[model samples]
Target chain A: MASLHSAVLDLRRLELMANGDSTIHRLDARAKVLVTLVFIICVVSYTRYELAALFPFFIFPVVMVSLTGIPPLFIIGKLALLCPFVLAMGLFNPVFDREILVQLGTLGISGGWISFASILTRSILTVGTAFILVGTTGFTAVCRALERLGMPQVFAVQLLFLYRYIFVLTEESGRASRARELRSCGKKGLGIRSFGSMTGHLLLRTWQRAERVHMAMLARGFSGEFRTHHVSRFGWAEITFITVWSGLLIFMRIFNIPHLLGALLAGSIS
Target chain B: MSHHIVQVKGLRHIYPDGTIALQEVSFLIHHGESVAIIGANGAGKSTLLQHLNGYLTPTAGDINIGDFPLTRATLPDIRRTVGMVFQDPDDQLFMPTVFDDVAFGPLNLGLSGSILEQRVEECLSRVGAAHLRDKPPYHLSGGEKKRVAIATVLAMSPDILVMDEPTSGLDPHARRQLLALLKDFSHTKIFTSHDLDMVFELCERTIILHEGLVKADGPTREIFNNADLLAECCLEKPFSMQNCAACGRPKTGL
Candidate 1:
């Protein structure tokens, strides 16, 4: 009953976030998608040795999490796990070739510092953009956006099927895991053989469930197409939101504006 | 006499494994009539219903719905009109929300904007499930889910509604509510059930299937009165039939 209650709670939370009345949530998923794309491209086009310029790109993730009410920790946590690998690849520049590139006259910095900064920035930007896109829009809206933007009908339908059945399959997997645990309590406990058997049984159950679902869909007049009730409304606000975001990203990327400002402010203060 | 909305001729179905599910099963169902296809487990009743909507291609013979042949090409159109509701509402109402599930068929049919909303709303009301519009199918009670599943097809505005054991696993009140909703529908309706009382009450015509064949097809009254045929198909007479022994004529006005 607790599990059932939690399952229901998770579903309710997802539904609320997905169909919320917030302006960001209400914007056409396509618009959000376009904004995310533009933001990522701007971030990726930055010079690999540039670090200060990439700091401004943090605005994208911040705005996404704050405005859309998407959990920031989830996106940040996911990115934290992924970005380190790409960042580590760039870390080798400082180890083998630490040549002094620019002398601040009063301060000292090496060429490896700039390259390391660039690598870190690139990884952060790419991961941040991905996080913003998925965290705010969720998978269902993202699929609908893709479909509306002329994605192949087959792919779109496949996505919908995957989304619908994933929950069912996940539930079955959980049940199988629990059953295995219960049965093994008095025995040598579950091993690879039991795990394989559980997986096999789960697959068989899912297959039957899929067939039943297909038949059910046929009964309800489904003709190899996916449909939903929520229609995303594309408006001038959505257009303007993307336009403003894109312009800001382009401006920052085209002119190293963040670094220029940082230097000017540092010079003026000193 | 009403027009026979569904006409089947020598319908046969064999699984790829060569297990025969239906053998030369033929029947006629009139429009605005509730017909119950009753049988024991594995009696080809479910297989027969599947054929009606072209869910399973007939191994041989033909099934004609209103004039259109049930075939690969015609399956979509047949599905649009036939509206098959399955035994498990969980499988039927797979959408995240009741409104989405109900609106699914209409949306697929390309009805947009206000017209789509109107159709979905009307269907939900028809099934007396308007209050559950925003609720998820998984969150709903079994009975509520069943009604919502019925609403999903009802929203399509189909001509024929074929349900596989609609009353199965429902409590008596839920069953009665479902029966009432079925009785109110003007569409050609066929539901499979072993609930003899339900069959007697709502279905004017009854067909008993046994071992992949149509064993009996006649008026519900006649079918129920024939104790020998009922026992032969492994269905017992309803306990509510008190005057059946004294009355030689088929009972009327359930």
Candidate 2:
């Protein structure tokens, strides 16, 4: 219940940050979304055993954090929370293929270890980019941009509704959980059965709330589409942003900047 | 014009499970008249209000909003005429921000540019929520959210304002502010509430629903004065009508 309450607040904090009047936040959502897509593709397309090449990709999120003025610690906390999922996914990799693939002085690393590190790094970069995108551009604007970018109308609307209702749904469930926690004297009946029934009631209540919301929408002349009045055009700045960031991402993808830098440093030292 | 009038006759609604929520309900509210529908918990007040806006189809009855009958074809026009503010502000405000939620209806009506912005501004100011326009609905206090929800309905320029529980879940100050705002609206207003004091203060007409039927319908004072009738229906007079607690004498007019 406490986590649920914090989750609601965290979502609100991120959205509140998006309302800042900073330059990066003002850019059309489409530009940020397109650039983030390019960044994700570039980061994920790296080969399975390429660990050193992934270091350069961190620059994008770092730059975004500084420019957008979002608290780096908050984004970092979110990233850390997500790290375990990525870790669990790649945990078995080192056990499967132990053939030595790289040699750094005496410590020989196997293919599985290199690939596991690569997977973890890639996930961090990709997920970090997404978080930065949302931090700069609010979720509603992102949904609108996605709709304009050829995503199906229903899917875009569903995503927006999902984001909007998440707070309400979480708050309801949180209350339900707190109620159960308080009513279960001596911690009896605090197991899965009560949780299951509480969740079922929560689902039922959520369904009824959804129906009421749909009715409210209908009463407002909602024919189908959610019309927005504040129209933001992708202008010169957007074009420049997309072009420069995308070019940098592609360049990072094509060339191993980290490897080249390491070689140059070694040569200069010798 | 008849656009502001709401008329219902022989309205009956039986849920699919065979429990009748409303039975033989009828009322005709004139333009600019404020009416309060009051009843016990299972008295079908909400079920009746839902029928007014066409959210729930009556099993057997005819509802006429303005000149047209309540049917799928005329639903849009009826909705435009009768702006419904639901009980929970959360249900009414689904948009991300207060501005967007206030502008949702007008935007769906094809408003754009400065005109739309002006409309949103006007409604927000009407509810004294202009400062909270850019904030998301989830960030607002309960009273602010309720005001924004009212602003959303007001943006549509409805001829008749229908509220389920306008003053529910509000502190005394917020409830007073809402009552003042409702008093200033020069249009037909219909609402359902358990706040008997609010019902007595705002509505000139009061309808009592008991067992999904119209138990009594008349002037607010007369309806509240009939102690025997109110007792039969398991209701009581508004607090303002009761005697002074300390002095044990009748209170002055509300």
Candidate 3:
């Protein structure tokens, strides 16, 4: 229960970070959103053997984190929580494919190892770019950007509502858990027997709450759609931001900057 | 004759599972009158409030708000006419920022640009929440959230305001502030609350509900002064009345 409470608090802290007036935060949400999308597409478009090429892609998220004053450790910590799933997805690769692809001094590297590394890199870059997007633009602004970019209004509203109610749901469940703990004494009273009923009660409460919310929405003249004051205009700065970032992303995608830099360094050393 | 801004007749609501939430409830609220509905839990105050905005179609009765009948065709006008402030501020303030939430209703009415911004700003300032314009609803304090919730409804310029448990879960200071704010609103107000003191302070009339029925309804003073009726409805006397009784002062009629 305590950990759940802190997790919600951490989410709130991340949102508060978006309220800062840093350069990255000041960039229009449309710009940040478009750039992040381009960055992700470029990162994921890399071939399996192109691990070195993915390293320079890290610059987008790193620069975002630094410029926005979002803590590197916090973003890394969030990524760490998701690492197990990414690791699991690629863990069996080395055993499945044993074809040697390259030699590293005295050791042979297989295609499986290279692909596995590529998967990990892709996950990090994509997830990191997503975090930077949210950290810099905030969730609401991102939703507005999505709507402006021609995403369906219903989807944008659904995303906003989901984010809004997640806290309410978490708090309700936390209170329920606390009540259970207080009465259970030694945790003996709460087992699978009670868990089903507890979850059932939670669902019932959520349904009733949702109904009330719908009533509130109806009272406010919410017909079939949601209306907001968020009118995002694509100004020159936003266009410039998108143009510069997309061009850079395309250039990075076409030519492997890490491989080129490595070759140049190797040549200069020789 | 005083015009009835809201009229509900033979109102009954049955849940899909067959639980009778409300039955045979009827009431008339006149223009510019402030009324408070008091009841125990499950007394169907919330169900009755939902009917006013045509959110919950009464299983057996009719509701008329101003000239609009509570029906599918008139739902939009009914909603616009009767602004509802929900018990939970979280549910009401669904938008990301205070400004957006306040502007939601007005924007739906097709107000745009400076006019929309001005309406939102006016409501926020009316509730003393203009400072929180840019803040997300989740970031607000409980009292601030309540104020913003009221602003969200007020921006619509409704003829009648319905609030469910407006003062629930609020601290004494917040409750006092809310009471002060509610006092300033000129709209025909209908509120459901367990706060008898607030009822005594703000409402001129009171309706008590029990077992899904209109158990009693009258002037607030008369309702609160009737100790026997209060006991029957599972309600306590307002704190001030109890304090007056404690001091051996005879209860005086207002």
Candidate 4:
């Protein structure tokens, strides 16, 4: 019961995230995608041993959250939940063969730690960037961007159809599950037997819905390609904003500034 | 008389599972003519409409539109010439905004820049949907969505317009508005509708389909006057409309 309530709440939060009004949401989708991509690349390129140096990279995430009005807690919480998978894959490296590579003031960190840290960092940064992009740009805008970027029209139309009908299938599945639960009197609890039947019924419903949707498309003058008229223009502000973020990322990579800054500050303080 | 824009000869369509939706259907739609296909549910009305636009291939017959054969290679041309307005606006308007939905067809035909924008604007205005251009389709009222759906095909500038259940679920005012708009179009029209009153007022010809077969096809007045034929097709003559003083005198055949 508690889990269901939480799930509903999570869905609402995601809806809010997707529909939020902020500067990030207002930017052209191309600018947002490019910035997010650059941010991911910079985060991934950092050497694993430079843990303290990586702290400055948090600025990118923080700025994104504050400007986009996305809840910091929500982004961090989602990333934290995904951490276990990265940890599991990397944990095996330490257990299989232990090889100490570096000694930092009488404490030894092995070669496995480097790889583990890389995995963890990459996972957090990639997922965080993806979440921000989708939350800010919305599905339709992302699709439009992809279309403008010269993706095949057939594939674009297919994606649009998939997005349009996914909800119908989910609603059907929800009703079927409720019916099963009501009949089962809470004992069976949607086990494999009923689940199989529910899935099959959903597939049939989807098939029927697809036919209707295709007919509808044909009626609307859809021949082979899906076309839309949502125009996007990269204003001067959007261009500069994207340029600055990309330039910073590129500069950081070229000069190794994150590492040098941390080392300089540490040497002066100690 | 204008040349026949749509010529379907012995058209038959049997579903893969062997459910025959259309059998031996024959019809001719002349240019600038408005015809209605009417019957009760499961009457193969939609199946025949799909065949007109080359959406569904016939099992054992031919459909020719303005000298263009309904073959796989000629589908694009057929679609450009014959615009189809489906029953459900939700399925037809797949784009996020009304403007996008209306502009879909024109864009597919590779119309870009100011010309595409001009056509989209004109189409929206034609359907009286210009007010809702930027609004998302999911937020539209049913009538508004239907209008946008109509605009989407209108943007294609097809020579023949085929609509499926155009007035279904519309309020009387919206239905009247749609009927008026459709009446103004010079293109050939083939529509399936349950609104008998609208059909009688707007269509010069009516085709009655029953159980995947054409039961009656002729002048609208002649078909409406045949009470026994109407009863067999599960259709009732619009007595209220017939008796309405505003609609004026009854025609000779009815």
Candidate 5:
């Protein structure tokens, strides 16, 4: 519960951070979206046991975080919450592929461990890029960007509604948590039964709210068509932003930068 | 035709679960008039209001906006003519920012470019919310959200304004400002609220709905004055109309 509470608060900060007037925020959302997509694709395409090459990809999110002036701790905290899901997927890798792949002075590391570490690294890098995308360009702007970039209008509308109502969901959940705390005789813990019923009630309430919002949209001349009126256009800056970022991302994808740099340092020392 | 003339005759609405929300509810509201529909909980105020814009099709009878009846074909046109402010502003302001929400209706009507920008700005300024344009709805106060929600509707330039409990969740000052804004709109205004005081002050006519029925419909003053009728509908007079709590006599205006 505490983790979920902090998660909501931190995620809300992403929306606030998106409103910042930094260079990253000023870039068109479509540009950021495409850059982040290219970054993710690069990160995800690495071989299962490849690890060192993924290290350079961390620069993308780091640069965005610094340029946007969004606190690194916030994004790290958000990423840490999802790390366990990646952990579950990678934990079994070490058990299945146990062949020794690398040797230190006195210790050996197996292929499974390397693959597991690689999986974890790729997941974090890809997910971190997405977080940066949303942190710099808001969810709505991203939806608009997706729509303008040839995504089906219906899907973009769905994403918009989902992003818009997440606040309402958190608020309703917060209120429900407060009410439960108030009645629990100074006990802050939520019981399993209460959690069960609370989740059911929240679902029902969210469903009803969705219906009401749909009616409100219908009342305001909505005829199943969502029109994007954001005046932000694709221009030279956006073109440059995408070209530079995608070029860098694809360059890093093709060449193992850390490996090449390490070899250069080793040869210079020789 | 100037804006909107709402005429409902024997309108009935039944939920899928066999709950008859409205039964034979009828009213005629001319353009440029302010009317209030006040009732207790479960009295069908919301169901009746939903019919005005074709949000919910009436189980029986008809609703006419200007010259056309509320039908599937006319739903779009009537929705354009009648703007609805929902009970919860959060439900209406679903856009990412106040500006987007205000522009949602006008953009749907195909008014883009500078005309759309001007429409959005005009509506936001009308609601005294131009300063809040770039802010997201989640950041707004209750009153600001309400103002922006109304601005969303006003951007459409509807002839008839229909609101469901417009002032329900507002503070006193917010309520006061909303009433002042409502008074400024020259087109037809319709509201369903438990705030009888607002009805007495803003609306000239009041309709009392009781158990899916129009218990009474007449001048606002007369309806409030009828203590017997008010009691039958399980309602009380507005605080402004009730005798002074500390004093022995009715208020000065009465």
Candidate 6:
């Protein structure tokens, strides 16, 4: 119960960062969304053994965090929450293939180890850029941007509703859990034995709540469509923001800056 | 003929699971009059409110809002006539910011550009929530959320306003402020609440529902003054009325 309460609060804190007044935060949401999408695409498009190339992608999130005045700890904390999934995804890579790729000092680095590093680095970069996008632009603006970018109205509305109700659902579950805890008196409550019934109860409650919410929407003239009043224009600043970010991302993808710098430094010293 | 702004005739709502939620419930609300529906939990208060705007279809009954009958085709117009403020403001204020939530109904009605903005502003100012226009609904305090929820409905410019437990979870100061705001509105108002004090202040007529039936209906003063009837319906008289009776003072004007 305590963790659930704090989790809800932490989510709110992360979203509150978008309220800051800064250059990055003030940028058009559409531009931020498009740039973040492009960044993720470029980072993930790298080859399996392209660990060094993926390092440069970290600049996007770092610059966004600094420019938007969002706390680095907050972004990293969110990243940590997601790290387990990414780690699980690449955990088998180190055992699948054992082709020796190169020699670093006395250790022989295998292709599997290189690819594993690449996957982890890529996951961090992509996820970090996404975190920065949401932190700087806020979820509402992101939905509006998606709607304006020709995504279906229903999908955009679903995203908005899902984001809005997550808190409500969390609080409901937290309260229910608290009630169970109060009655269970330090016994093994909320265990596997009770999990099924608890989930079923939660589902029923959420369904009823959804019905009430739908009725409320219908009462106010909602006729099967979710209409938004946010009017986003693709002006010069938005265009420039998208173009500069995309151009840089494509440049970084095409040319391996880390490899080039390493070779240049080696040649210069010799 | 008198203007019956809202008329519910023999309204019977049966749940899908064979539960009779509302049985033979009938009522008429005149224009510009405030009515309160008071009942314990599961008294079909919410089910009845849902029927008013055509959200829930009656199993066997009729609801006429203004000139439009409650049907599939007239749902839009009926909803436009009856703006509902939900019990939990969070459920109503689903939009990201207060302004958007306020503007939702108007936008759905196809009012756009400056006209939509003007309506939102007017409603927000009317509810004293203009300063909360840009704040997200989640960021608002409970009282502010309730006010914004009212503003969201008021922005549609409905002729009749129906609310469910408008003062359910408010502090005394917030409750008093809400009562004052509701009192200032000139539209036809219908609400369901457990707050008898609010009913005394804001509603001229009160309807008590018990076990899916209208146990009593009359002027608010007469109904609250009847302790026996209230007790039968599992309701206590308003504290003010009880105090008056204890002091042996005459019932004064509200």
lDDT of 6 by residue, A22-86 (tens): 87777778888889889888988878988888888788888787788888998788778778898
RMSD of each: 5.4, 1.9, 2.9, 5.9, 2.5, 2.9
The true-versus-predicted C-alpha distance at residue A40 of model 4, in Å, is 2.4
The window of 10 residues in a row where model 3 chain B has the poorest summed lDDT is: B245-254
Candidates 1 and 2 compared: the better one by DockQ is: 2
Span of 10 residues, lowest total lDDT, candidate 4 chain A: A3-12
Those runs of model 4 whose alpha carbons end farther than 4 Å from true positions after fitting are A1-35, A45-54, A61-124, A131-168, A171-192, A215-244, A250-262, B1-4, B239-254
Say which docking band candidate 1 falls in.
medium
Candidates, DockQ: 0.51, 0.77, 0.62, 0.30, 0.64, 0.63
Query: Which regions of candidate 1 are displaced past 4 Å?
Result: A1-12, A43-53, A69-141, A148-150, A186-190, A224-235, A254-258, B1-4, B225-227, B239-254
- Whole-model alpha-carbon lDDT for candidate 2: 0.88
Interface CA RMSD of each prediction in angstroms:
2.0, 1.5, 2.1, 3.8, 1.9, 2.1
lDDT of 5 by residue, A38-146 (tens): 8888888888889999998888888888888988888788878888898998889899998998999779999999999998888888888888888887777888788
| Quality of model 6 by C-alpha lDDT | 0.84
Q: Where does candidate 6 chain A have its weakest 10-residue lDDT segment?
A: A224-233
Question: For candidate 2, lDDT tens digit of each residue in B152-214?
Answer: 999999999999988999999999999999999998999899998999989999999999999
Best of the two (2, 5) by DockQ: 2
Chain B TM-score, all predictions listed: 0.92, 0.98, 0.94, 0.93, 0.97, 0.94
lDDT of 6 by residue, B107-156 (tens): 88999899999999999999898999878788899999999999988888
lDDT score, candidate 2, position A134: 80
Q: What TM-scores does chain A show, candidate by candidate in order? A: 0.73, 0.92, 0.88, 0.77, 0.88, 0.90
lDDT of each structure? 0.79, 0.88, 0.84, 0.78, 0.86, 0.84
Candidate number of the best TM-score:
2
Here the TM-score of candidate 4's chain B is 0.93
Model 4 chain B, poorest ten-residue lDDT window?
B238-247
lDDT of 1 by residue, B137-162 (tens): 87788889899888888787788888
Candidate 2: lDDT of B149?
Answer: 93
- CA lDDT, candidate 6, residue A59: 82
Q: Is candidate 1 or candidate 6 better by TM-score?
A: 6
The residue ranges of model 3 lying beyond 4 angstroms of the native Cα positions read A16-28, A186-188, A266-270, B1-4, B111-114, B243-254
